[model samples]
Target: MAKSEDFPGKPRNAPTWMSGVGRAPAELPEPNLRVSVKEMLAQQQVNEPAAKQAVADTKVENSQAKVSGKVLETQAPNGVIAEISTTNIRVSPFQPRLSFNETAIEDLANSIASVGLAKPITIRPIGDGIYELVGGERRWRAHKLLGRETITSYVREMDDALAQILALTDNEGQEALTEYERGKSYAKILDSGGERSIRALGRRLGVNHSIVSRCLLLMDLSNEVKAILDTNPGLIGGKRAKDFIEFSNEEPELLLQAVTAMRDEQWTQEHALRWLAKEIASRDQQKTPSKFTDKEISGIGKVRVDGKKVELRCEKTVDAKRLAEHFEAFLKTIDRSLIISE
Candidate 1:
């Protein structure tokens, strides 16, 4: 038997599809007749055996596209002026919003001029001749500087979010990318996704959350400081890198100056930090008096007693006789007539 809610006014024998359609069946099968999962598996094995599958799916989805194009031309896109692509292919518009050191860029430009672009940049076509850079903007810039007519590129159609992720991953895979580049990539992940949480980004990238967070923090530092960090691998340990990030916002200029001094003057982290503290204190104008008084001996000597306990101190580097003469002169100034001991 079935309730009215279960079957409505239709017959219990009515087909499931007929229940919703115009026609109603006269009767329905008992619910107890449904097959169990174990029975289904047994029947399936008898009909067609299951096979093991590979752990990772290497095949790219068909909906995605990949194409090659020669470096037709390159142009400075947006405020990022420097290089051009060979072909005006349509690409995703998600530009990597980060800055690079002019010095580094110049080095890259020189390398490109000398060796040519070693790798092709990836891009996804948006529409028409306009293409969005997926990866290899740096390479593109280099090639543009070289005035190369044609270069290799991979073009695909990807969603905006996926394109950004792909760009980030692609950049990260390159061994040549500097620490600053890695930091910029992490920053891009935060900017693209509303969740600027480093932990979440690290989980997505299959890396430890702290690493991602530290890299992102590095990006907040000025380029001059970042350049120093890049040059001197030992300026900050893993622990200190995190500390630097915490201070980036509060004392960016000081941090930059300190980093510059550390690199230029070959100062240790402790020295740089001490100088920074002193500068900060001076800015507050909280000065203190000197601890030493004029009466204190300026040199080393022994103590003696006449009327009062007196100590002999010397300023010049001389023998005991010269020191004695200095003491006699001092006594004459005090009394003009006093027995002196040799």
Candidate 2:
């Protein structure tokens, strides 16, 4: 028999009956219940430390990603102060940005050098320690030309639309835009949520509505005409260019030819338009009948009838009696005719 102390909750003889004669009824081993619970808790503890370490590392990396650079300390370089020499820096190919006269740039450069940059350029970081110019490219250029290294600038984080506007403002203020440049800039403004009408853009730029409309038309000209204008900006004024727009698309080749002729021969706008008209007429002649015709009369002279009017033009050598007789016969055939002129 097992003693009560040997089996804490069982009767002394119960162990023996249940199992064999108890030599302490084969004691069951204690189940390892804490093992799984302790393991799960331990794993959670381990993950907590790892998560904390990861957060710390991420913060440190973020801090290290900030932008860093200093402005150049020297005066602007000479070439940089002048107009942008690259033709590829167009605002829009179809509608170029306006251009300012050289005289204006020179004046502004002199002012800037004397008094320092009145307005700072705006730039935004593009990555890899480089910054894309947002605005004040002209000022930046001038400073570079003045042998300057460090320039006064406004560093901005901007979206595409704002960046374009800043760039345009800077270009416009610095007198770096051409008429075409002005037109394109106006177009950008029109497209960028400010206003869509040419008149509105003209108002913003302080120009007439007609001028703005003309510039818009110029946006549609072929590259050839644009090239000529770009080469010699003063070749034609806004008014002439406006008139040229009327013919640019319909007669591109002829328009270009006229522009070339005008440039080479220094022809006036009137002469160029007239020459273009004549060329157009000649081309039309090839496709259709003659616009004017002459008819000969027997025993008389040739007369011209231009659809609306009939006249007899004779050389001095013609006989007056024969001409008079033919005229009388012609009038008789017509029955009743009015001759008011002598």
Models 1 onward score TM values of 0.44, 0.51
Model 1 lowest lDDT segment of ten? 73-82
Q: Please write out the lDDT profile of model 1 over residues 8-111, one tens digit for every residue.
A: 57556766565696666468767656774334434434534231121012233442332223211112121111123555643334444344455666688798
Candidate 2's residue-wise lDDT over 1-342, tens digit each?
765566566656555545765465467999766653224434434666664354334432212222332311111221011112222121222223334455655666787889766665555545554555666545655665666655554444555755655565565544445566556566667777666677765666567888667666666778897788766555555567766777886899999998898779898778888998898989988999766778887555678877677777666678877878987988777734354434
- Residue-pair clash count for candidate 2: 33
Once superposed on the true structure, which residue ranges of model 2 sit more than 4 Å away at CA? Answer: 1-67, 71-111, 188-211, 230-234, 261-342
**Stretch of 10 with least lDDT, candidate 2:** 73-82
On TM-score, the candidate that comes out on top is 2
The lDDT for every candidate, in the order shown, is 0.57, 0.58
Candidate 1: residue 178 Cα off by (Å)? 5.1
Candidate 2's TM-score: 0.51
Superposed Cα deviation of residue 310, candidate 2 (Å): 7.3
CA shift of 165, model 1, Å: 1.9
